[model samples]
Target: MDADLVECRACPRLVAWREKVAIEKRASFANDRYWGRPVPGFGPADASLLIVGLAPAAHGANRTGRMFTGDRSGDFLYAALHAVGLANQPTATRIDDGLELRGTRITSPVHCAPPANKPTTEERDNCRHWLDTELELLKPTLRSVIVLGGFGWQALLPVLAGAGWMIPRPRPKFGHGAHVRLTGTTTIDLYGCFHVSQQNTFTGRLTPLMLESVLASAGRTAGLLP
Candidate 1:
């Protein structure tokens, strides 16, 4: 499934943009080879906790080929995860940077980096099936999910409902530290956190302590911590 997901080009606009940025190359990453294809979720298959972000960064994951890698957003996220005992290390500069998630996984609704970090509704819908399939495969062991930002929160609710969980009508609102109970064959808890984007982090909107608190709470909820 991962092999097939990597070759996806279903969204023309996303395809063009990801590939274009790859070839042009950022000045800082000119010597680095870009993983311009759809970046797959990273972490163990049986992860009990999942972190869903909006999408890969144009020059970040699109360049390093790993979710949240080579970007300030990733720097903020990994450090928090490490602090909360959910990651082996805090640095995520590259795919081979030796960073490891513990009983947790990171993924995005739209795998490809969208232009200007925004994916059209159509593009977001086009990429739904990948996440749909991923949820089914992870359902057995998955216990909690932390959705970052409104885009990811909006995108994930329906997918969770379709994957056999009961999402209440009017839907759950998205807010930092918001949480909801999702009932299915197995109960799963869903959490909302502000995206660890540079805009949020640098502005003091989402601080290190804020992120670590959420992670630690989610990890304990998922039974990943005592």
Candidate 2:
């Protein structure tokens, strides 16, 4: 499934933008080879925790080919996950960086990198099937999800509902620390967290302690940790 997902060119705009960035190359990483394709989710298949992020950064994941890699957002996120014992390392510089997530899988609503870091509504809908399939595969062991930002929170609702998780009417609002439980053949809890974007972290809108609190709470809820 992952091999097939990386080859998708379902959204022309995203394809162009990602390829353009790959060709132009950020000055800092000018000499490095860019992955320039859809970034696939990373982690063990039996993970109990799922993290849904918005999308790959144009120069980050699009370049490194790993979700949140080589970006400030990933630095903040991995550090928090490490502090909570979910990740083995506090860095996700590249795909083979020896950083491993113990009981969590990280994915995004849209697999492709988008222009200006935002995907169009159509692009999101087109990419929904990937998340849907992922959730179906993860449903057995997945106990909790940490959705980063409102985009991921909104994108995941219908997918989870489609997977037979009973979503509440009107839906739960998105906010840091907001949580909702969906019960079905398998029960899963969803928790919202501010995205680890520079806009949030640099502005002090999402501090380390705040991220750790949410991750720790979710980890405990999922039984990843005592």
Candidate 3:
């Protein structure tokens, strides 16, 4: 599954931007090779907890080929996962960093990194196929989800509905700590969290304790922790 995702070139703009960043390498990582491809969701296929983010970071995941790797955003996320006993380590530096997640998986709505960290609506829609397939495969064990921002929250609604989860007519609004459970052939409880971006963490818009609380709640909801 990951093999196919890495080879995707469906979005011309993303294809160009990702490759450009790989070649123009960030000064700090000038000596390193960049993955410069779509990053697949990371964790066991039967994970009970799924985390969805907006997209890869131009110099972060785009460089390491792993979601949130080599970036401050990953630092904030993995640390919280570790505190909840969902991650083996509080660091996600590279694909082979020896860090691992248990009972939880991390993915993005947009696989490829976008210019200025924003993927246009078309790019997001074009990328939905990957996420749709992923959710279908994870349906059996996926019991809870944590959307990392408004973008992910919005992107996941229709995907969940399409996948057989009944969505509310008015739709739930996105807010930190917001949670709703959908019932259909399968039930999945969704929780919202502020993105672990520097803009949120550094500004105290999202604090360590706050993020941990939501993760802990999801962990309990998924029966990953007591």
Candidate 4:
């Protein structure tokens, strides 16, 4: 699955943009070699808690081949995770940075980096199947999900519904700290958080404590914490 995922070119615009960024290179990271392909989820496959964000950052994951690495947004997120004891380190600059996640995983709704950090609805839907496949594989242990933005929140509900979880009519709204539990043979707790994008963190819309609080809640719910 990992091999097939990295080679996906289902979206032509995304294909061109991710590859173009890899070749042109960010001036500050001119020495860096870019992943320039679909970035996969990171952490143990048996992770009990999942953090879902938007697409990979242009120079961040797209360059490092790992989700949330080499970016300020990741710095904000990992710091929170470390404070809450889910991550061994508060920094992720490279794929092999000695970072580790404990009973948790990070992923994105869209795998490839999109132009201007925005993917069209078509592009988002085009990437949905990969998430579906991932969820199927995660069903045994994925008890909770932390969605990082409205885009990911909107994209995820349908996927969860399609997987046999009963989504309430009119659907749950997105907001920081919003929590919804879906019923199926097994239940899932869905959490909403503001994206850790520079726009949010820089403006203080999402403080480190706020993120840590939610993560702690999810971790306990997933039985990853006391």
Candidate 5:
């Protein structure tokens, strides 16, 4: 079922651009076929922690079927996840690379690759249904959400509020290890960190160690590790 969604072509514009990029980079990902459509969420479905990224990169996850894979952003993210003991492997170069995630899952608010890495408000609204369904399926056992960047956090804030939980006073801001605890039957923790995109990493906005520390704290809060 999840596999089918990865091969989906529901968004025509996304499909065309994805194919165009794949063809342009033919030599690099020669044997690699573009997942090129809508990249589905990755990691354990029953995970206690959900890591929400902004969106797929043009040549990254948009080309590979897996989330946060085949891109520079993924390189930093996977390294951090592995350091925190959530991933069995530290490297994610392809879709079928046999990497495994433990007690964690990674997803994006927008499934399709957007032009210039920015999705319009309408596009994000259109994709919200998928995220809603995803949260519903995982809500039973979900314990925490780690939003990767301001955009990802913004997209999820309303969803949490709509679930009958009151948001914190002053609201939670997006920063490394910034967290909020919801007032509800099951308390869910929200943490924020800078996105692991090339711009951020290259500019030293988010260091590798900083990201690893955030994941380490999340694992502890969710009881996935000590």
Candidate 6:
């Protein structure tokens, strides 16, 4: 999928709101042009473990054109991935920072930057097709997925369920190390740490150790590490 297409401003409401944010925050990101548009998936194209996040932060991935880059969330996420040996670096401050993934891929359910971090159901539904396509193109090798939150799990579950797999009842609720195995081949492990926003990290809601532990468990489950 082309990054530019994902960054599209087809939705009038989203376009207007994004433009406003760009105008208001012009000085901070003066050289940091807002992707002010949809963000595309990034990471190893042939990864086996897929990590799904909620959506792009207006000034974060939505601006940097890389999943989880340019934000506190990416900071925490990349640190964990690096700690687990799935990433080559410990920090991601820009889209072109040359960071690389070894065994994992990160993406969001909603490709576009939604206003206020909330995407309408219709918008989410529309984006699911892209998600489905991406999954299909990834092709038959994914062994596990790590969904970051309840909303992400909800968006992705139906697709997995439709593929002749059984999802757990009470739905395998989200929490650190929460996992569900489907069809004896693919496993969906959900780790529900608070999103690594400035609010959460600054408040100490999710510490580095906590996030690293989750990634460690995910690595073991996915057989990416011992």
What are the TM-scores, per candidate, against the unseen true structure? Answer: 0.99, 0.99, 0.99, 0.98, 0.92, 0.88
The models' CA-based lDDT, in order, is 0.94, 0.94, 0.93, 0.93, 0.83, 0.74
The candidate 4 region of ten consecutive residues with least summed lDDT is 130-139
- Cα RMSD (angstroms) for every candidate in the order listed: 0.7, 0.6, 0.6, 0.7, 1.9, 2.3
Measured by lDDT, the strongest candidate is 1
**Residue range 1-226, candidate 5, lDDT tens digits:** 4665666665677667777876775577777777677888998889899999988887788788779888889999998888889999899999888899998988888888888998777777777777877887788778888999988888988777766568877877777779788767567888999999889999999999989888888888778988
What is the per-residue lDDT of model 4 for residues 41-131, given as tens digits with 9 covering 90 to 100? Answer: 9998888898999999999999999999999999999999999999998999999999999999898889999999999999999999988
Least accurate stretch of 10 residues (summed lDDT) in model 3?
181-190
Off by over 4 Å in 3: none
| N/CA/C clash count, model 1 | 0
**Pairs of residues clashing in candidate 2:** none
State how far residue 196 of model 5 sits from its true place (Å): 0.3
lDDT of 6 by residue, 24-134 (tens): 654678776776667777777777778888888878876777788887788888998898898999999887788988778888788766787888887787778777877
Q: Which stretches of candidate 6 lie over 4 Å from their true place?
A: 3-10, 23-26, 184-193
Give the clashing residue pairs of candidate 4, or none: none
Please give the range of 10 consecutive residues that has the lowest summed lDDT in model 5: 1-10
lDDT for 158 in candidate 4 is 93
Tens digits of per-residue lDDT for model 1, 37-99: 999999999999999999999999999999999999999999899988899998999998888
Selected candidate, larger lDDT, 1 vs 4? 1
Candidate 1: minimum summed lDDT over ten consecutive residues — where? Answer: 94-103
Worst 10 residues of 2 by lDDT: 181-190
lDDT of 3 by residue, 1-226 (tens): 7889999999999999999999999999999899999889999999999999999998899999899999999998999899889999999999899998999999999999999989999999999999999999999999999999999999999999989999998999999999999898778899999999999999999999999999999998898999
